[model samples]
Target: AGSSGSRGPSPLTIGMADTIPLAVAFHEIIHSYFRGTEESKCQVKMSGDMMLSFPTGIVGVLANNPNPAKLCFRLKNIHRLDNVLPNKQLISINTMMSTRDTTVVDFNMPALTALLRRQSEKNPTAQYFNVDILKYQIRPKAGAASCPFQLVAYWKCEQDHTDLKVDYKYNLHAMSPPSPLLNVSVCVPMNGEVKNVIAMPKNIWNGENEQALWRFTELSQHSDDRGVGSLRARFELDKGPSSKGTISAQFNCEGATLSGIEFELVGSGYRLSLVKRRFVSGKYICDSEVH
Candidate 1:
């Protein structure tokens, strides 16, 4: 690391030497983040030789930019960028388009409807949902650094003929390593008198808030789309005090109702109110008050 008259390693020279390795590392990190439990062990490691082979290709892409200032701005704003130089900038539009076809041939008993009716009769407390990801696509547009992704989810509600669906499209500029999400699903008994009361299963009701009607404890935690993406939250009678009634629940994903179920309470009645909704940095909605 020889220095010029400045007596320090040249920032420009170090940026050049470090850029290739940094980009390689970033690519490998993306793969690891998407790997699920079944594919946990699968990841491609980049070697120094492999990185060197793409030196010119990487630099060419960076240098050909029409505006150098834009490059610096992009580098600075990168979520994963570092202090020294803009984090390794790797913009490759690898177009990947795949279709998935699934036809559920449910050939059992008289029909799906009849079978579900009989099952519901036997287990009245059970909640049934036939969920499906109706449509999904990752479309790569020409010359765009980020790729556009579309997702649609649908489900059939047997209790009521409610066709739940969610349609959303977004562009992915960069992908980060998969981080675990604190997913919790809990169904606490609703206090009949109080509109909203915080009740802990193991202890007494300590606090009360508009969003504290029903408490939720994390049954499990996982990352976004890492594996078994959607979480199942259910409310049953045995754990709660009420005998049975009905609770109106409207589950919405990105402004679209994915699933809505009105539980027919046999003995007691309960209700849920969504209080505070916070949008994270990436526009991911986090419901703080799901009572």
Candidate 2:
């Protein structure tokens, strides 16, 4: 839908939108069928790396894209408390985390195992799951904004108007990689407010032709019934002729000093690791092999 301030991109290709959803649908269905079993047929291809043969026993073309490239458009959690029956029915909250709720929705559940003895089931032709993201901060020690994860989900039941309990995890990666050498401190606030005060990564790349600046490539978080549970941070080189240097992040919270750090691709990744460990008293350590 177009709006007053900006026009949205054209609708997504039907095939592309259905790709990840299809995978997620199967995952959920397997979980339902297996119930208490630790091993389920769905586990056959748990990792996206393996090719899976469906009911037809035919394997579809598996894409070679990086695992990180898969779009996690929606994240949901099934809480035991809200079910219709005691220890019987399962209640799941469907969350859509996009700017606009997707109008078209469908669901399918097939009896993947003989133990269930159920045939394929599909939801109605259309449904909607709206998602809202709230930021919460993690205090240095304890504070009103103290939390580990960055994202939150809210849901209300139409029948009772009672607040529905929901949980979700956001796949958020820090734009910067966690440093092995430096101590990194992260503070989560209420409503996705983050006071990042971790020492910057020490640049290791010094080649004349390589880029050597530090920058976060990704940042995200997740929330659920128990509060924040997901955390991630990733950093990459910025454009510039290769050069090496030290960076620092510092912040204070509830009388505690919090810091998480990284040591970058300098000519001396080894030495940088040692210096970083000493820098944050072994706070957020980076991989020694990251040269």
Candidate 3:
């Protein structure tokens, strides 16, 4: 998710965040009969499975072994910003998972906010963004855990500029890379006409709608033979004073999941199946000023 805010003409601040949930449930027999087993075993299995899809194959465990412990995992290319408004400038992306079995289950997950903070401190580049994460947890019954995570990244810049640009980077080392279909729209102030718009590696252009569409059937992680996909644009100002406009984007990445958390049936003969989904959300508003 990504958003933008303008103090005068150009954007002064940009914000972005992505949230994904990792849920687990075992067969009824396992929950009832394996009650004496240490929760650490489950955590280890879930962590290992989740790391399989990560580019670096690494994740930080913020909390461990609570009745319902919370864990946060950072995703590189799974989630993206769909839309950006210069004046409104706010971004949010989310992926959720759950189980329908009526059986009582014990589970542990991540505290996304705490994990994000710890990640920033460890990475010099990320520290520059001043990112923030918000987390929410809900227990439907006595032993079930449900948590929702939100991460926000923000940057501040100058005010009187005329151009608008955004970039999206994919994790080149992911075990399974994502293929994203993207649609980007920029609203040019009536006072100024669009000068030029560009999408890296090039893409279809719609002058009538002031939009760009990109469909990456296959996107690979950064490597010696392959590179990440990104898009950017520039808007030129017209003769009149600054006016108001908007910039928005939308995209879907298939076969890419955020968390690698999973559950196994410890003592039951019943089979268990896993389902996953991923997507992005946000809008940005652009405003102009007269010099």
Q: Which candidate number has the best lDDT?
A: 3
Error of 2 at 230 (Å): 23
TM-score of 3: 0.32
Model 3 alpha-carbon drift over 4 Å, by segment: 1-164, 172-191, 195-209, 212-215, 222-247, 273-291
Overall local distance difference test of candidate 3: 0.27
Model 3, residue 176: what's the lDDT?
24
Residue 73, candidate 1: C-alpha displacement in angstroms: 21
Write candidate 3's Cα lDDT for 76-160 as tens digits. 3212211211111121222343223211122123333344435545863431222222121111112111001111111112233
Tell me the lDDT of model 2 at 176: 16
Q: List, in order, the clash count of every candidate structure.
A: 11, 53, 21
Worst 10 residues of 1 by lDDT: 256-265
lDDT against the true structure, per candidate, is 0.21, 0.19, 0.27
How far is 261's C-alpha from truth in model 3 (Å)? 2.2
TM-score of every model versus the real structure: 0.20, 0.15, 0.32
Error of 3 at 12 (Å): 60
* Deviating ranges (above 4 Å) for candidate 1: 1-15, 19-191, 194-200, 203-291
Stretch of 10 with least lDDT, candidate 2: 23-32
